[model samples]
Target: MSMPIESMLLAVSLNFLVFSVSFDDMIGQSFASLVPTMAAVESAIGLAIFVITFRVRGTIVVESINCIQG
Candidate 1:
């Protein structure tokens, strides 16, 4: 439903923000530096997995609800 999508979006955005800040601090570098490349890639992969799982699980949940209603 819309709720799941909205929550997933919020989670992904927050994850990206936290990853960026932590990665920068851990390497003592700014996002403009080369050190951010690996961190950015990892974050993207994690976000993708999170989104995929959310979609799959949300579909299952909604379908179940529909079944019950009918």
Candidate 2:
């Protein structure tokens, strides 16, 4: 399934934020130093995925829609 570009970017940004915060808490590292490096890597990966998704076609269809009907 193809995701919307805006949704993909938002998801990537949120994921980065959550992971960075969790890593900081777990590792007891300095946020200032860690954030930049983490952000750079996350952004690079997100951009690559965005480009690839943009080029790809077709939305993914699940066989079951019952779960979404609530």
Question: What clash count goes with each model?
Answer: 0, 1
TM-scores across all candidates?
0.35, 0.34
Give a tens-digit lDDT track for model 2, residues 1-70: 2235545655665666677688666333333345456556776887786565545533323443233343
Candidate 1 colliding pairs: none
Give candidate 2's root-mean-square deviation (CA, Å).
Answer: 10.7
Judging by lDDT against the true structure, name the best candidate.
1
Predicted structure 2: lDDT: 0.54
Off by over 4 Å in 2: 1-31, 58-70
Q: Which candidate is the best by TM-score?
A: 1
